[model samples]
Target: MEIKEHYSLKEHHTFKIPVQARYFAEARTADEILELSRHPAFRSQEKLVLGSGSNVFFTKNFEGLVIKIAIPGIEITKRQDGYAIIRAGAGVNWQELVDWSLQQNFAGLENLSMIPGTVGASPIQNIGAYGIELKDVCEGLEAMDLESGEIREFTAEECRFGYRNSIFKNELRGRYAILAVSLKVSDLSAPGVTYRPTASYGDLKTKLEAMDPKTLSPRLVSETVSEIRRTKLPNSTLLGNAGSFFKNPVLAEERAKQLIKEHPQVPWFKDSQGIKISAGWLIEQCGWKGKRVGNTGCYEKQALVIVNYGAATAKEILAFAYNVQSSVRETFGIELAPEVNII
Candidate 1:
């Protein structure tokens, strides 16, 4: 592992925010990560672990050791009870895993297609879409504790997943660097055996049916979900963005009823806690949708996405987000929390 000084972060992160890291290194193996953990700079300086850097925003340059997880591999480790266990290296692109699972006739993970990040980030974010989340198929994970430099394992229950959240995002945040992820998917090797896919969420069912395929499969679901995302969200390559900027705020039962009574037209659905209000619809109600300030704006198609239209400074983008949050709070008395981790 070669540690570099003053590395530009504009390309590392999807936001394309022009910033630099004081120190940077890429680890492609478990041993390399252990070695770096013992390095003098790692022991002395602050550290930030990155995986594709898709769900983060930086207000200023990170003056710390940025360890980019680049480890790569994917394989079906075992199969039993009609389920196949697929293990993927942390740095493997999330979309590629979904595609691989489908190609190998393993069922599950179709609804999560097009999510921009790596397997290492899946558990950290508990990424979800179209009625499915990473927690649904995740069997376990392995990570190297930065402080101990010892490899440890965690089961699905230990992850404590909850709607784009996990223990990794909370109590264990930054405590360890993920090395690999294991997923349990249905085995479809037998003839006449088909796995029931997730297609009931949003317009997924309708879109999938419109395709009019001979039968439903993981590949079909993946393609339909990918198509929907391509239409609703902007491509980070064409336009710098981190998908949804804010999460749908969940309110208590009584509070949700009150809000529904006041603004009955606003979109919402039942959440695990109570009612989940749509952040995009709320921003639109506040007249921030499609509104632009300098080089940043809400994407014209989806208000949930905050796009940096070439050359926007990190502070400018942050200020624009603050303005949106303020408007939502002022109008609906609802506090909109950002989903992206701001550093």
Candidate 2:
């Protein structure tokens, strides 16, 4: 792996934020990652492991070593009891793995299809959509402790997954580099395969049924979800963006009840911790949807997405987001938290 200095980061991230890294390198295997730990700068320089840069917003140039995990491969290491354990490299594209799983008739990841970033980043964010979350299918993962150069395996339970959160984001943040993730998926071709495709969340049922597929299968769900997303979200290639800038605020049951009573039009879903209210609906109600302010603004199609019209600095993005937050906090007595990692 070649390490470069003062590297331009414009192409690495979907946001297209014009930023540079003081030091940058890509690791294609676990050995390379351990090699990175032995580098002279490893112990002295601030370090960060980056994936596809799909879920981060660089507010400024990073004055640290940025190690990009590029480990690759996807294979089923175990199959039994009508199920199989598929292990994927952290560097593998998330959608590619999803498509592969579908092609092999492995069921589980269809709902998470089209999500940006790499497999290495999945467990970090506990990525989910429609209904199923990564925690639901993840069997385990192997990560190298960047500090010690020792590899450790983490079970799904040990990952401590919450809504869009995991232990990787909390107790273990920045300490380990994910090398590979293993997921258990139902073998649809096996006799008496009982895995049922989920298409009941949000408008999924409506759209899936509209397609009129004879069998509501993983392939159909993947395509339907992708189609729905394409219509609601702008392509990052044309417009710079990290999808869903803010998370749907999870409100307590009583607070949710009161809010629902007061604002009957706001959409919501139940969460294990609380009631997840639509951040997009709230932002739209605040009149920020499609309202471009300087270089950044909420996307016209979905208020949850903040887009860069042409040139947008990280400071400008933050300013616009802060304004939106102020409006929401003042109007609804709730604080808006950003989902994107601001750095």
Give the Cα lDDT of each candidate.
Answer: 0.89, 0.92
Can you write out model 2's per-residue Cα lDDT over 162-237, one digit (the tens) per residue? 9889999889989999999999999998999965878768878788767656667888889888988889988999
Model number with the top lDDT:
2
List model 1 lDDT by residue over 245-300, tens digit each.
Answer: 99999999999899999988987878787888999999998888888999999998
RMSD score of candidate 1 (Å): 1.4
Residue 308 in candidate 1, Cα distance off native in Å: 0.7
Which regions in candidate 1 have their CA more than 4 angstroms from the true location? Answer: 209-214
Tell me the deviation in Å of residue 52 in model 1: 0.9
**C-alpha positional error of residue 104 in candidate 2 after TM-score superposition, expressed in Å:** 0.2
Give the clash total for candidate 1: 0
Give the lowest summed-lDDT range of ten residues in model 1. 190-199
Model 2, C-alpha of 20: deviation from truth (Å)? 0.6
